[model samples]
Target: MSTKYKKLILSLILDAIGLIPIPFFDVVWAPASAYIMTKMYKSKEGKIAGILSFVEEIIPFSDIVPTFTIMWVYSYIINKEKVDTIVEA
Candidate 1:
């Protein structure tokens, strides 16, 4: 498997883990997840998404946002289309 697909799978797993409903888990998981996001994605986009993930996880009941997966989609799907279009132009 390519690195991109590996990152996608990792993002899905991270998002699923974030969904755990254990009380106060967010307090500990939030920062760790954010760090993971930054390291996993890298670059400015990763930093931005990492911040968003941190905030989303920290807020009560907002862990369902799946920020990592969303970032993966944005990076691989949405951003890829834009790049392809630009190249085709």
Candidate 2:
């Protein structure tokens, strides 16, 4: 698999693992998600995603949405060029 797919899968897996019913799993997930998000796209959107991923995972009960995966899909699948164009604008 490409590096991008690998990152997406890893982030999703981490998000899944963060679902374990334990305290402070979000703390671990947040930074990891942020790193993955920043690495994947390396644009303004990616930086924002990194911050949002951290925030989303840190909030209680917010991990249910899989922000990293959603961002990945949106950036790479749903509207890849849009992110670049918007970032460059």
Candidate 3:
């Protein structure tokens, strides 16, 4: 499979793992997720998304946001159009 699809799958798995309702789990998972997000995406956008993921995971009841999946879509789909347009210009 391509790296993009691999990233998508990984993001889904990470989002799923984040949804677990274990009490105080965010204390450990939040920072780890932030680091993973930065590593997975890589760039200014990745850094921003990592911060958002950390905040989302840290906040109570906000882990359902699916930050990784959203970032994947933003990076690969939404942002791709802009890059393509720039290249075409």
Candidate 4:
């Protein structure tokens, strides 16, 4: 994949990681996710990844997994690339 798309994917993964629940809400999660996804939207696909990250923030901690799943689907639809890997860092 091109470096830009790689970066976008990396950013999306970062958003996903941030969305993962903890004892306290990660306040930085949604905004960071939104910023990266907005950048991706502006760069390539028109769909917004940040919005899904926002949804995770709006919901309770337990709901993050479901939100992540939805976002993954959205990513697939928009990117059309079967990237088997997901980032941990």
Candidate 5:
């Protein structure tokens, strides 16, 4: 598969692992997701996604959404043009 798909799958797995009900898992995951998101996309959207993913994991009950994977899809696929517009601003 392509590198992008690999990164997406990795982010999804990390997000799922972040959901485990173990102590400090979210703590580790939140920052990790942030870093991964930043690495995957070097743009404003990536920065926002990193922060958003971190927040989503840090807040209890907010982890229901896989922010990292969702952001990946949004930035790279679903709304690629939108991110470019934001970056140009």
Candidate 6:
């Protein structure tokens, strides 16, 4: 698969694994995944640092939505671009 797809899948898997289920995983996964995504995302594509900062600002619970949305956006963008390229080619 493409590097973008790999990155998306890896991030999702890591985020899922990082979750602790009951006690508190939001505490750990928020920062961990945010940092991972911030550093890993294509700099030209999205506001990675800004997203990370937003997540950081809210702490654990706050990150829950943005991170997932960003990942989805990443995957969507990549796939959409691929489809467009294929159609043009």
Q: What is the Cα root-mean-square deviation between model 5 and the actual structure?
A: 4.1
Top TM-score hit: 3
* Tens-digit lDDT track of model 4 for 1-89: 86445655665566458656565555666565566555544432323445765665655653445444444455555445633333312
Kindly indicate the candidate among 1 and 3 with the higher TM-score: 3
The parts of candidate 4 lying over 4 Å away from their true place are 8-12, 19-21, 43-48, 62-89
* Stretches > 4 Å off in candidate 2: 82-89
The order of the candidates by TM-score, greatest first, is 3, 1, 5, 2, 6, 4
TM-score against native, each model: 0.87, 0.72, 0.89, 0.47, 0.78, 0.49
What do the candidate models score in CA lDDT, each in turn?
A: 0.83, 0.74, 0.85, 0.52, 0.76, 0.51
The residue pairs found clashing in candidate 3 are none
Looking at candidate 1, the ten consecutive residues that score lowest on lDDT are: 80-89
Better of 4 and 6 by TM-score: 6
RMSD of each: 5.2, 4.1, 4.7, 6.8, 4.1, 6.4
What is candidate 3's CA lDDT for residue 62?
91
Q: Which ten residues in a row have the lowest lDDT in candidate 3?
A: 80-89
- State the lDDT of candidate 3 residue by residue for 15-76, as single tens digits: 99999888999999999999999887667778899999999999999988999999889877
Q: Stretches of candidate 6 above 4 Å error?
A: 42-69, 75-89
Clashing pairs in model 6, backbone N/Cα/C closer than 3 A: none
Candidate 1 has a TM-score of: 0.87
Q: Model 3, stretches more than 4 Å misplaced? A: 81-89
What digit string (tens of lDDT, one per residue) describes model 6 on residues 1-89?
87546656765765555444555655655565656555554453334643564465346544334454455565466456633222110
State which candidate, 1 or 4, has the greater lDDT: 1
**Residue 54's lDDT in candidate 2:** 84
Error of 5 at 86 (Å): 13
CA displacement after TM-score superposition, residue 89 of candidate 6 (Å) = 27
Tell me how candidate 3 scores on lDDT: 0.85
Best by lDDT: 3
Candidate number with the higher TM-score (2 or 6):
2
Model 4 is weakest, by summed lDDT over 10 consecutive residues, at: 80-89
lDDT of 2 by residue, 1-89 (tens): 86667767876886686577688777887788788668765778778988988888888987787776787788778986675553211
